[model samples]
Target chain A: MKAFETYHPIVLFAYFASVIGLSMFYMHPVYLLITCIGAITLNLLLNRKSFISGLKFFLPMFFIAAIINPLISHDGEIILFYIDYNPITLEAIVYGFAMSIMICSVIFWFGCYNVVMTSDKFLYLFGKVSPALALVISLTLRLVPRFKHQITVISHAQKTIGMDISAGNPWQRVKSGIRIISILITWALENAIETADSMKARGYGLKNRSTFSLFVFEKRDGFLLGIILTLLFINILGSYFGVTTYYFYPTFTELTVTPISIGLYISYASLLVIPIVIEIREAIKWRSLKYNM
Target chain B: MQAQSTARADIYSRKRLIFSSIIIFVVIPIIMLIGVTIFNDRKYNLISMIIVLLACVPFFVSFERRKPQAREILTIAVMSAISVAGRAAFIWIPAFKPVTAITAITGFAFGAEAGFLTGATSAIASNIFFGQGPWTPFQMFTWGILGFIAGLLGQKGWMKSKIALIIYGVFAGIMYSFCMDIWTVISYDGLFSWKRYLIAMSTAIPFTIVYVISNVVFLLVLAKPIGEKLERIKVKYGMLNN
Candidate 1:
């Protein structure tokens, strides 16, 4: 496991929640830069190949999202040009760019989140809040792979009967597809009954049913949680004080660099940099230990 | 046995009615008020997400309170997993997914709460494969509401007719796109703009038509067989009858 992911699920969840939330709400260019860099860097550290490949999808989306606003919105003082008679304004373009960046940063953070918060971690976290629903989610997650396997089995069996989905006319193919799903439904539902019977046999839904999990909260987790909460509190305070709010409509506000605003920027940066720092530290520690060996 | 089961149904529907009323009447308004006043109409994505999550809480709380049987929970799991797998089965066809049909069928057989759970759970579970995004909550809420409404309408006799099913299929398609587009418009500016939303909707018309067609086709084709199968399972396993 990576160093950051090794922390308690609570800490990881909180960190992603706060970072993604802040990324969505804060349109300040500086804050966006910090978050975008942090998210990209963290993603690169965690999964470099996938992060680079994701850009192929995100790049077009980013440009489309950024381009659409100016075409539709004509709500600024500085008019750029007429597009088929409607004036596109500087403010609209700027707002579009900012919103696009915000959207991209949030998506990137989620990429990082997806990497760090595996389904097991997510289910573990969710299990604390709603155990029954969590179990339902867990069971569904488990069943998806099994169902896929069963689909293959069922399809092969059906193929032998000349009802092959891939080798039929268009209409026949559609019929075969539906038939496969139909047969799968009957098979799954019938099998589910036996699964439930086994569960009942094993004393499911009993009182005070204890769930076994591997996660345990250590002192380091508490300390990391403390740091995250503190930084998050600072960022929220900064937002509440209107320091993080940037205006792109009507007229652009002059970028101000007050001490308090600077402090808020640093705090936000530090918050995002926590995981990157931890990963780097871990890498360095492992390198030194390897050298000693 | 019949009288007792009817009594149980009465209690179940009553609890659901109370919860829905509280959410629709009180909770949603208060949330809108807060969203408008405090958020100044920004953060529509976040605010609506919170609202969606809040709307689902009552259903789950009641489900938990009822001490749901293993088979009951397994039924929901099985239905949700099927919907997720259904998406995979139809992966070749872009914009054609049987998730809504399966979820709606589950609601038709099981009840609104099970339908809602199936819709919401499948949304998240499928995202594990497709990748989760800011739109996950919106998708969950949209599909869940589709199932929820399907369950309510399924309780009536007329929803079994072909015309009613067609109407519902079109409605579910439009509703899914409509709900999903709110996030699209909001994601652009962190607030809602009618002009931008109109543009987004106009551009999305082709996809929406596909959704409507696919939903109708799937519902008409899959509804009878799957609904019958689900009913048989419920009867055989005595699932969710409480």
Candidate 2:
């Protein structure tokens, strides 16, 4: 089994949560790029199906996110050239490149999150803190799949009534579309009410209503989680001394290398790839097992 | 006597909204604009977004503190859920989203606070399906601001006509693009640039137009039916009377 995927839900949740939280909170380009590369690589490896599909929309967005920076953010020194007296600087382009990389990586990581943290995992993590919030998230997740199904059913019913949107004028087409929406709204609300009623009848919201869950916290999970926490601790401590800090605006800072900083970087890199290493180990075992069989 | 008391309460809440709206919509952005300009720092941008969200959320609670919260909460949640679902449902209409119109209508029917939460919730909840990024905060801010404004205009009877509502929708679409454009620029350059902002604005004109057109279309279609039903709920349940 893939050790990362099969870890205790809490470990996986903590791993993803810490990764996303840290990535967003940091503005350091070097650290961010390292994490970005790690995130993208892991995402593509673990969630290839969604990676390919999302690339269709996400690919263009990545370029747009990067290029738009140099266009609108005119900060930094080291002028590359002048576009009518307003200089287009190397710094801005580099900042754009880094920011875009960070953005794409965060998005890719989120996609990986969706693949890894199913509704059950999220509910398991958050159910006790606030059941209402958990319910809303789970309900919203369910809504997408059912919504697609209902649309086809509604469209077919409309076709039978000879009010086909495809055959109509622009105004009529919009009217028909609105009519379909109106119908869906009524049905959806009624459905929501029924769900609320059913939930209430089941003794939901009772303080003593205990949950049944199959998730178990194993020893291996605890060991991995300990390692993850240690890496995070060192990284945060190192950040105060500006380990990954690289200034771009006004002027670019000369890159520095030191032993402690190297240690910090190595820890951070290992933290990012812990799951990947686990994944590779599992794949190699599978290959060896297949040959033996 | 009953009518006069209700009128007085209405006046008080409207006054509170105007004050809070100024803080959320005007004061904070100015602070961010000046903070970044003077400090010449990128860290401030990140902190400012947090400040923007934290500062506005308390005001939302203040507006609803004395009101019946259950109905308001349920309504906001349901409407946000609807808007999020709608965003995912209509994938063919690129750049056009019913989420903004639905958020605007929620603000019109409920108060600005309700509108804000609905919009914010719509953004976060939809991103569950659409995928989240650094842009999540920006999306929440823009949509919440749109709802907040719609509520203010509704309170002032400015949204009286269908035409006015449609105009608001169109303006909101442009505002969304502009705000998102600001985010893009800041995210790219690590700071804002007026010249580059203008160029980015021009390039985004086509997308903005599509957004405006979609807002108009969705509002025209959904406002009457949804707004009326919500109005009926407000009266029937006598909910959110504060």
Candidate 3:
């Protein structure tokens, strides 16, 4: 298990929510750099393989976003060049880069989020607010695999009967595909009736019924939550006061440095780096323990 | 005793009425206000997301209030799961997912609310595999609304016609593409710009065409069989009556 993921679901959730929300809003170069680095670092620490693979998609998206803005929007000054009688401005390019980085960074943060906040945790959170919907989501999650397995079974049966999906022309293939899905749907809906009956037999909807979960709010979790909230509030305060706001249209905002701004930057960076710090500390601790053993 | 029970039920429904009204009328605008004022830069994506989430709140609240039976809930679960897992069956084809067709079928058989739930829940469930991102809520709202509209039309008995199915398929395609492009334009430009939006839409014409074709094909092919099966379940089990 990841060390950072061991925090209470609420703590983890609040941490990601604030980080992602802040990443979206704060476009100051310093803040964006901090978030981008923080997102990439946490993603690398948590799930490197997927992160690297995801970049294959993210990179092209980034360039397209960066390029498209200047092509369409000609609001900025410092025209770099002309394209089909349109002048490309430096400000738009910078703005585009900023937007792409912010977008990619938010996506990376979500990548970390998906790794840490597993479905069970998510369902637990929602279960608090609406148990029925959460139960529905849980059931759906369970049913997806079963349905997929059943599709394979149905397709194989069809194949034995010589209606194979892969062994036909495009039109024939699509027909076989639809036939397979149609059979699967009938089977699933029918089987679900029995599943529902079993659930009802177990008194599934009894009033005052309680939910079971293994998660507990520990002291460490509370401590981390407190720290996260404090930092988040400081950053929000910074944004509210216009300390973390930057502009790229018309002209660039002079990159300002001040005691308050530096303080805000530190807080933002620290907030983003919290999980990375936790992961590194846990790894070092584990290594030493293994060596001692 | 019967009179007292009736009175209690009246009060219960009244409370639900007020609750849903508050969520729809009061809370949704407040969320939009916050999104616009507080998160002002390129905040359309964020605002639309909150609105989408708020839009689904009333549905869930009412569904919970009804105290849905296991079979009803399981039925929705089954539909949503089928839609998500159905993506795998078409893995050979690119972007020709049956999610919308299946969602609309759920709505047509069940009701508007069930349709919305299946659409929204399947969006989240599918993203659980595809990896959740900023677009999840928009996709949820678009598909859910598609289902909601299908339910309304289905209730009118219009969805039975071949022409109606084709038109709805075309509409769902355009709706999905146009709605997603709103996010695309906003995220790229950090705000809404007509010029940028038009360019984005024009560029996405091919994708939109694919969406329209695929949706039309799936709905034309799958709607009848799935709708029949769902109707059978409802009739045989005597479920989802409310």
TM-score for each candidate, following the candidate numbering: 0.95, 0.80, 0.94
Error of 1 at A182 (Å): 2.2
User: What TM-score does each model's chain B reach against the true chain B?
Assistant: 0.89, 0.82, 0.88
Candidate no. 3 TM-score: 0.94
Question: Interface RMSD in Å per candidate, to 1 decimal?
Answer: 1.6, 4.7, 1.5
- Model 2, A88-149: lDDT tens digits are 88888887777777667767777777777765876778665545445555666666567667
| Model 1 chain A worst lDDT window (10 residues) | A237-246
Per-residue error for B175 in candidate 1, Å, reads 0.6
Runs in model 1 with CA error above 4 Å?
A166-168, B1-13, B19-41
Flag clash pairs in model 3: none
Residue-wise C-alpha lDDT for candidate 1, range B32-85, written one tens digit per residue: 887677545376777777787788888877877777778888889999998898
Q: List the pairs of residues colliding in candidate 2.
A: A69-B188
Clashes of each: 0, 1, 0
Report how far off residue A70 is in candidate 3 (Å): 1.5
Q: List model 3 lDDT by residue over A163-192, tens digit each.
A: 998897999998898888788888989999
User: What would the per-residue lDDT of candidate 1 be over residues A1-293, giving only the tens digit for each residue?
Assistant: 28988998999999999888878777788998898899889999998999999899999999998988888788899987898999999999988888888888888988988888999999999988888888899999999999889888988999999999899689999888878878888888888888888999999988787889999999999999999999999987787667877788778978899999999999999999999999999999999999999
Worst lDDT 10-window in candidate 3 chain B: B39-48
